[model samples]
Target: MPYWRLSAYYFCYFAFVGAFSPYFTLYLKALSFSATDIAVLMSLMQVMRVLAPNLWGWLAEHLGVRLPIVRLSALMSLAGFSVFFFTDSFAGIFLGMALMSFFWSASLPLIESVTFAHLGTQGHRYGSVRAWGSVGFIVAVIGLGVVLDWLPIMAVLWGTASVLASIFLCSLAVPEAVRPLAHSASASLGDTLRRPEVKALLGACFLMSAAHGAFYVFFSILLVDHGYGKAMVGGLWALGVVSEILVFMFMPRLMRHYSLRAILLFAFSCAVLRFALTGWGVASAALVAFAQVLHGATFGAYHAAAIAAVNRWFAGRLQARGQALYGSLSFGAGGMLGGLVSGLGWETIGPAWTFTLGSGFALAGLLWLVWGWQPGLGEDGTDRPDGGGR
Candidate 1:
């Protein structure tokens, strides 16, 4: 299955995220862009995620191949990102981010489909293979933080570009899999989306990611505003992912013992608390640390659970589209809304209230999930105990 090669792809892919997520805004700040401008620029990526994945997914399904599309997307993203080196104007930067992020967002869902196809019946091992991505994230966050302290913020451009290049290179080595899905006579993608449970799941995912927009957009800026150093900010970012890595390590055990619904609910609960602590507890390192630890639930466990549900629900020809729809609805639509509103909120109300708004989104998502489940249904909306959704 070329497991290490797949792992390498994950590592490089998320290394790009780790670099861009924690430090890119700081880079924008160095360019003297306003909060709104930065928010718009960042949200542009999510906006692309909203549209790009579906397009690429449809193409993959049509072509009956995934790796070639992934390779093309990675290459385009890398080429697009290189534009950052030549321009600092808001218009140029905006165009570059838009072009690059469109392709960057296109790759993950396809790769995920490929990875799961390779895993076949061993889906539980997804966490173990995926954990290296967290490792890469930690390395990038910590290393870039130190470099930011030592070098200029512009160095982030070079660092992120380097990782994008690596992503393209790694995509080249991942062999394609041709796992034919067992089709059902009556099942279709539209039917799956129409199911009440599916709607609820996607809704919850959207709000959950929306709640994260503030943290992704402003966590570093918040810390810096409160007198934290770049290196410490980097360390804190790494700390959260380290906590996430621990959760990933134990994910198989956790999945065996709990329903996906329960895991998601728990993640939402942690999100409610995490954002609040991050917003209101900046002065207390211990409180902040406590909040960071919740990342184990908020992202790590939640994502694994969500992916499992999607896999179970979207079998056969709809697999790639299923993952793409999930990404678009959650990270795309949800994250874009989160980024836009948080920017306006941060500008008008301050970080405390802004993140408080985020907590509200998480709480809302939690409630939405609870409301979605029928009184006696399982994860797949079946009435059997073995369904494990209840």
Candidate 2:
């Protein structure tokens, strides 16, 4: 498949998330639901993701037909999320979210494998392509927030469904990618797990991403409470992603000289600072905007590094599974836990305390990477590291 095709597809898919993340809880709040209920509902997606990626990745690895799985899941997701239009009852929303989450989580790990395959040795371009998804997110969130000010908030679901429908078409078109393979799957899984570096890499991702739990669940609401308008909400989000895009554009050069571990280390440091500042001001528009810029390093750089690490560690049959492990542990398990904790924590302890908790998570990740995982095996690109593939 063409790079633009895959990028556009991912962009559309994530745009749905952009719309959902900022406004979904607000929609529930409008219905008079409690904070706990809102958190549970918002967190259902992460819960579903915890195991779904591995299940789908296993299928793709064994069957070697990622596109088929991607398309099937996309259809299921569309059918699932579309139900939100008909009702606002807790049960209705619960079922709809459950179905969508179960299906939606299946796509990313598989897509990451496909993306790296297409990028070949220049896998650093992964960020530039992936950043388009961030762009799509910015466009959707900003546009939909304004739309909601004038329209029924539930319209977000219908609009998201349409974008998801486009993603389904792209799923059908994305070509199968070639992954390095060994014959037996069981041995590959075992070998990858036994690698010390794999363990450390997974640990680092989990810690850093756990810190984002607060931001995802409450950042917009926090802004709204501080007297920011809907348009400002979108502008702030767009600025963060704009910074992410800039980082992605220069990523290939960074990877050329710096180790993946080094990039990730820097991302973790930025995460610490970013969350600290976020937890501190929130009332100061300038401070909040500056914190958002750090998003480029925290999420953008961290993701590029993690994906590259997964690509190097997993050979052939283990490729999809490697990415799946990262998703399940980090975005899936970590995201769910973070959202659940923050959802209630935000209400109980307020923004500062909640964000402080997030900062701790990021700091834990930074320390692990700095002290435990050493990627100093090569400096001139002539040698392969012990925990990596060539």
Whose TM-score is greatest here? 1
Relative to the true structure, candidate 2 reaches a TM of 0.94
lDDT of 1 by residue, 1-390 (tens): 789999999899889989999999999998999999989999998999999999999999998888998999999998889989999999999899999989989999999999888888778888988998999999999999999999988899999999999998999999988765554453678877877667888999999989999999999999999899999999999889999999999999988887888888899999999999999999987888889989989999989989878877777678899999999999999999999999999889999999999999999999998999553344542532123221
Query: How does each model score on TM-score?
Result: 0.96, 0.94
Instruction: Please state the error at residue 51 of candidate 1 in Å.
Output: 0.5
Task: Look at candidate 1 and tell me the lDDT of residue 273.
Answer: 93
Model 1 TM-score relative to the real fold: 0.96
Candidate 1 has which clashing residue pairs, if any?
Answer: 379-389
RMSD of each: 2.3, 2.4
The CA lDDT of each predicted structure is: 0.89, 0.82
Worst 10 residues of 1 by lDDT: 381-390
